[model samples]
Target: MSHPQAKVHRMFEFVEAIGTLAFSEMPNEEFLALGMRNYWDGYFAGRAAPLGLAPAEVVHAVFYNFADGEVARHIPWVWGKTTPAEAIAVRERGSAAALRQLIGDLADSPGLVRVADLATRAAVSAPIEGRVLYAGLRALDVPEEPVARIWHAATLLREHRGDGHNAALVAHGIGGTEAHVLFALALGMRAEEFGRVQHLPKAQLAAVVDGLRGRGLVDAAGGFTAAGRETRERIEALTDELAAPAYDVLSADELDELITGLEPIAAAASTVDD
Candidate 1:
């Protein structure tokens, strides 16, 4: 049988797919209406709001995947456009609006209510040590509205797992850019396309790829070698192990219920333009 933690890990993408609509697919008009410059401004400011005007380096470190300069461009500046409290409110509002648009009356269904309660239990039960983003978010009040509550809980669980994933990458000696490369390859993304989407300069990306090749992680064609694939798998396994604790509060049946209830919502969220 697969490790129970592996089951928890499989739920990661589902929760993220749902939770990120708060910003990822938030209406551009609503974001602009906040006096924000663009999506990146809302993304950086809103997500980091829980940390209360944290320095760019802190956001960069916690976010772990964005290029440092990209983060520096937004933080502190974005705060000037909107206070942390306003960002938080808009984040919840946008998330709730998106969820309602996608799931409609189903947001109030008893199944979702139960899922929200169970997910909230698991999220709040997660240990805070070393989970900077999750810890900060957990310090906020849970939304009282049912749909908003579900989004809030999902966001908590997403960050809890994300913090653990970053630790796993660090332990494996995977740098931020390298992590993106590995993930892109794992998803069968072409290196050129990956670089384009991530906005990685070709020279910088080539340097990282060269470094990976030197470590026997990438082949001459820039694909993962056997060792490379194994390394990625091991890191993910460790991440799953670290994230396992958050789900300890759920019974087997409850866990299954949570997954079942979330599947449709995640599917709905995924239909939005990326």
Candidate 2:
């Protein structure tokens, strides 16, 4: 049988999709109307809003994936364009609108209302120690609207999981670039693609890959060796284990209901155009 935590990790993706769609699909005009220069400006500002104008270094440390310079380029400067409150409003509004567009009447159905309630309980009950981003999000007031409430709760859970994942990576001594390379190899994606998407310099990417190879985590052909795969698996398992605490507040039946209720909504959200 799969680890119980694995189920929570896997099933949470459907709710994650809703938040991802909201962030990526929010219209350009909406951002522009807020005096934000571009998508990145809005994205950085909106995501970091909960921290109340945090420094670029803080965002880089918490986000734990993007290159430091990439984060420095947007934050603080993005705050100059709009206040944290305004950015949060845009994010929540966009999330609600995206859910409505994707799931239609299902956005307000009894099933979703239950999900909002259950997810909120899990989110709020999550322990705050060492979960900086999740704690920041927890400080925000829950949205009154059903769709927004669900989105907000999902986002909280996502960040809670993300913080745990970062801790797992750190414990394994994997740096940010190395983490990307390992994940790409795990997904069978080309290393170059991750480099391009993350804007990592070619030399830096090659060096990280070389380091992985030296450690026997990667083969000469740029794929995970047996040990490498095992390492990645361990990291993921630990991440699930860390993320499990949030859902501990729910009963078995409530957890099942949360997962089942999200199934159709996640399926519908998946149909969105790429």
Candidate 3:
């Protein structure tokens, strides 16, 4: 019997690899500065250009994932000397450069080829459900390395999930910060302690919570009200529905196979620096 949950788990390995490799070290000033100088832009238009969205729309959409206050706080420090457009142009170059350096410095592990092969298999199996994500990733010009290919496939999958998640948030009328706060609450995280990883200001979080409480979605103590839990579940269900297309391309057994094949590589990569 094939299990859909297996596909989700399998796909997560690829997703985790990208997160570890590309984003985990983002808070490190040197890495953050480099990325801000090349990829991320604080300005609406600059950030919106590569995404092909209106600046205003992009600003709203970005907050769904990054939270506005955090982006504002970090941008000045990350790319003080660079313009948004300039940063966009060099984003890929910088990523590739970093990959080259990482690969050079690390011991030549056999996992590279294994992970790349698994990623390619998943990419080929990806269906039209991920069409937008696939197209966006395909447009990236990067070196022909196993690591690069894995990163590309992982990014496509990640964006596919993100696009769906964003749609769900909009559909539910959840403001960006409130959504994060509610989600953290739903997961049993203390709201006051949430900003450590998300980098949101305590005041910004409080304001969002106040609004949520006003709507009866949150309690005064920063816990989720009954309605809030339902809202969170609905949002997750819708997001999963939207992200289902790509996984639908593979058989349960095939996904399991992919997952099994990538396990060693995932373990190895996780030990590497972000």
lDDT of 3 at 238: 76
Predicted candidate 3 versus true structure: per-residue lDDT over 1-274, tens digit per residue:
2346446745665566653344433322333454444334423223333444334433454535666554554444433454544544444334334444455533245666665665665555545442443454445553356656665566567666666777788888986667668768877997776754355666776787888899898887778889989989888777766666666656676666667755654555555563
TM-score of the candidate numbered 2? 0.94
Better of 1 and 2 by TM-score: 1
Ranking by TM-score: 1, 2, 3
Q: Please, what are the lDDT tens digits per residue for candidate 1 over residues 50-118? A: 999789999999999886598998888987788988888888888888988888778768777887888
Candidate with top lDDT is 1
Q: Which of 2 and 3 is ahead in lDDT? A: 2
Error of 3 at 257 (Å): 1.7
Q: Indicate which candidate wins on TM-score.
A: 1
| RMSD (Å) per prediction | 2.0, 2.2, 5.1
lDDT of model 3 at residue 129? 48
Worst 10 residues of 2 by lDDT: 21-30
Structural RMSD, model 3: 5.1
Stretches > 4 Å off in candidate 2: 1-3, 27-29, 195-198
Window of ten residues with lowest summed lDDT in model 1 = 1-10
- Native-to-model Cα distance after best TM-score fit, residue 220 in candidate 2, in Å: 1.0
